[model samples]
Target: MSNEPDQQSETTTKTNKPSIINVAVAVIHHKDKYLLGFRNAAQHQGNLYEFVGGKIEPNEHAEQALIREVAEETGILLNDNTIVKLGRLHHDYGDKQVSLQVYKIELTVEQYEQHKYCEKGLEGQALTWVSKSQLLAGEYHLPAANKTILEWLKLPSTIVITYPLTHFEAQSNPKGAWLKYHQEKLASDSWVYIRLKDSDSESVAEQLMKDRPDILVILPNDNEQYLDDKHFSTTGDTKTTQQVVAKHLTHSTLIQLFDEIGSSTASIQSLPKDYPLIVSCHDIASIKAANQLAKARLNHNLPPIIGAFLSPVLATQTHPDTPPLGWKAWADLAELADMPIIGLGGLSPTMAEKVIMYGGIGVAGIRQFHQ
Candidate 1:
């Protein structure tokens, strides 16, 4: 849980100037593997399987740097039409700091070689296509760079619209929506929108497996309204909602849902309990209920819970001027809570990738489920 900024010092003894500057790199992919190049005998000599592209000069933006560096090293002629911006990375090499902007560009085997990979004195070194499994085996050098590449690779190759089903009402058309969403996911075998509901918590939980059994099932919060008929709540004389939800969905699928900050502290007091997955969704409050719950569970020796910032869609209607929690707050909460948090608000798959890049699990939205 280190919060040290990954940046090098500005003053250098040799240059007497800050070595900090902007740099850009391209993560080129052909199919299941990524195109990785070995560093020449010049830079990081033994650093095997590093991403292509290089440093940005003054008066040049990240895109410009990537285009120039790719051509220089691989002789690939890239245009504004070809390069796609993925995201940016900030790292401190101790001697120099760089705000590394990353891009993902696709090329065919013929195009890659036609570019004259080693025409100049750059020295092609060695080029290979690496899969995620091989990358995770720790055979590659540059652990930090490998981690960055892994993060990008985990992202869904195709756009995924994730719907967060917190209630039956949120589904627009519950039965039909679930059927259609499930069929599409099964056909493509690519995307899924988790339905989070508590009505017939057991029956609905069972149907999840019978229907689109492969997709993940997230249980909705035990709000008072939903619990009134279900006979469950965090407080009062009744079985805690968490216990009921856990009992039914534990074996069915990975449970995903937000815990009310205030009640979560008491809800998850036991340790090493068998629960599929947990997400705490406490808003800005004095006690930081989510963090307290995570600490208590961690202290008791339970598994880590996923943290989430709950931005109510109703808030957009009532408080349009209020801004949702940004990446920094989400990252801070995840670090403090010692858990990965997902963005819960008005979000889509494209935005979810952005959230994950900024240190989150992903995005969950109620509106997204209907679509």
Candidate 2:
């Protein structure tokens, strides 16, 4: 597949191939639809769909390149401030390697109303606004490199990390308060990371999974409880029966896995492929480790790393003694990550936009989510 949809000719190969081509991609959103362009059969990865964007110029930053490309191809001038970072993706087609600097632009209502019906591209391509559901369902065929980006696009901007069950039970209506509160707090199609540390957390997770099949519930990777014989049993209410539970690994568990596996590329496959994995990264080292693990799994065509949680972006009451990473430090570390980074700790749903602006794909928190 071709990296540039607008280029009419095949790319010339240099004697020494460059490491990778850096492309700027814009996921222009207006309400529930995203602006897309159809590449002609003559073009590379031709006759398929693509987001509106092009190659980054020598001195141009990703945002600048995206804005220029979008304007050139669609005749829509984009404000630089409106571009929000959506992390990056690196993929290899054997013939070509590309690193996509993906960004998101939420169009104003006026812009959408004016251009929503436009089907003709300013360039020689067909422009269309595809619904998010259509994209997720694979109705529009995108390039192979866009697989992970599309998956990331499906994620909600805010994820609720549940407080321990005990905390919820302490309330007046202990019998059914926690489930009711969670049901109310979580909107349809939202995500919740269950963090209960008690013995019954698995049973509680099973209930949540059954009740809210519309939502995604991620369980912590507790070996003692989730790895025992019952977890993999064929019958009964095992995590595997209803659905394989996605796992969230703490920084320590991630570190341990990385160390135990060493550099054997095949060892990465030891991590279960039946479920998605999310790793918590508190520092640059942990981020690097998580990236390594993700790269290894990608080589094996395993389930992609859902995301990495980078915490303490801001100080909170629970951990006052530990200084917050602040936005600058958090962004620096986040840039090093291969998977989408979710900014956690001292963050609220309201701050999700800011988190994306600072290089995170989403936001996660306990008390803030509870509120």
Candidate 3:
């Protein structure tokens, strides 16, 4: 995690009382130049160039607020289709904490200046198209505004989709039906599973190339009786799934799975340095798994280990146990596992919010269908 403090924390943590409702800003751009405006007031006035946006009202959504603010300040009518939610920033400004839902809008330079010099200029004094590189050079007036712009530049352009790899088949009766259903629901970037057959562990690499293609697959020990490996083979499958995956999907997207810490550590040792691994744990086994892997220093070499299915309260025939811990447990476990964690198990978009709030990478769901 970056050591820099979140700007929203300054405003949010100052007073014990709950802060006002959310506000936001949109970084409108054209080519390499950004649209910046000078605040007319004293608090952030005097040549201060900031992204055009402001406080969201009682009944307004963040996106709606952004549109209204932009138009109100610069007389530019922004359509809903022009907006894209990049991410959010939470900052504390001494007395109040503000959650800034950041967005990006692309518009032509001519359109921008038309609004800037419009007869109905409402709030800002001037508007200028500044190159992103120029903004990075620290010529901006407001320090916080500069920081926000810099942070936006650092964020990835595409939203990263992190998913879990589970042991499932496309032909195992009810299980197969469920697997196929979920597989179809997966986002293009989401992770999927591939079980290695017992007969030819060596051919696992070849099979992956032919069937699953670029998906990250879980290779379990073949035990014939253990639920995970009942259908797959475990003997002489010494080459880690990560190794096999690395060989086939070198430049493609693929993440391997390690059921327990012992296997994870061993797999890390056997696989290439760059092969991604998904560390899984469900039940008491996770404690030993994480501890052993950490002890072996395998966690140090591998990429972030996404948390697999974990439920604090197990569902029973009679009734459900406690409510799901959501990302709290996953966050805690990820800290111990020494890797970034993505919440799995029964999760929804609402649950995913909690996962991100608690410092998780993202959320993956089996029951939820992808649009």
Candidate 4:
């Protein structure tokens, strides 16, 4: 056999530092605008705008600490229901290290203004609301702590892939079912990968999303829209194309991006600085490649691979003989990832809660999620 690395081998690295100081950060959002703070000249990383948050006290859970801090910092009250963990971040300032337990905070339109009414000089900064487009394009200089927030935007909670050519039994027609899924699912603001059996089906899925253009749709089979395919269009202005997540790209494509660079980590430095770039990984090498790419982006001060899907979590009809990464192994793997990791292969939506308990963002599947 050739000397190719074991595709299944584990090469991804996760750092655990007990001394890294924990900081609870908030990404307070209302409507489509995010609440940001302009760091005053007196503070650390002064003059740079970033998320408003503070240190976590002893014996305090991240959510509780975030609630207390936000109240103290902005005079805004955030309850448990309005908060969700985005991910974590470890940043070294040379003098000391900080481990940020980041969370996404939501509030009503009226209450969103509560931040502005706060006592002057709250947390020694001025708070302002900014749109995601400006923030993602690097129009503003936000502190490094905001990186993971952008990463989580790429790592959606539930990623539903489109079904094959055969029509669903529950519905009389296939198009009807697809429309229903879009109507019910897309209404909540989520991401879906339209990997139809052929171009016609993928085209239909694209048209269905025309009305609700806000939802993210990934087209894996269409060459023109597929970023990894030949004749790939890099049309950032097109809403349909902008949400595209480059999937299952070839080794050559990555090599070309970083040219002669053996380190996958180094290659990541070439990705878009503010937006996320995603690729599918089946083995340890690809995962490590993604890890390197993420590190490389961070190294160059850019947005890197936000997350990845660990495939074949359980054996299926297509690959019944392939040993799966069982629940514990999958969960353990999730724990190591700094970004949200989604489980795939024979996974069902019902199992998503367990996946979260084990550290994953959620589960994705082809037939299991009734693709």
**Best candidate (score: TM-score):** 2
Q: Higher TM-score: candidate 3 or 4?
A: 4
Estimate TM-scores for all models. 0.49, 0.86, 0.39, 0.59
* Model 4 lDDT tens row, 27-78: 8777578877776565456677777677677899877888888888777878
Relative to the true structure, candidate 4 has a C-alpha RMSD (angstroms) of 10.4
Please give, for residues 288-318, the per-residue lDDT of candidate 3 as tens digits.
Answer: 4543443343225342222333333223222
Report the lDDT of model 4 for residue 271: 40
Ranking of candidates on TM-score, top first: 2, 4, 1, 3
Candidate 4 lands at a TM-score of 0.59
Top lDDT prediction, candidate number: 2
What pairs collide in candidate 1? Answer: none
Q: Write model 1 residue lDDT over 140-168, tens digit each, in one string.
A: 76425334444444434222333333323
lDDT of each: 0.46, 0.75, 0.46, 0.60
Q: Quote the positional error of residue 293 for candidate 2 in Å.
A: 2.8
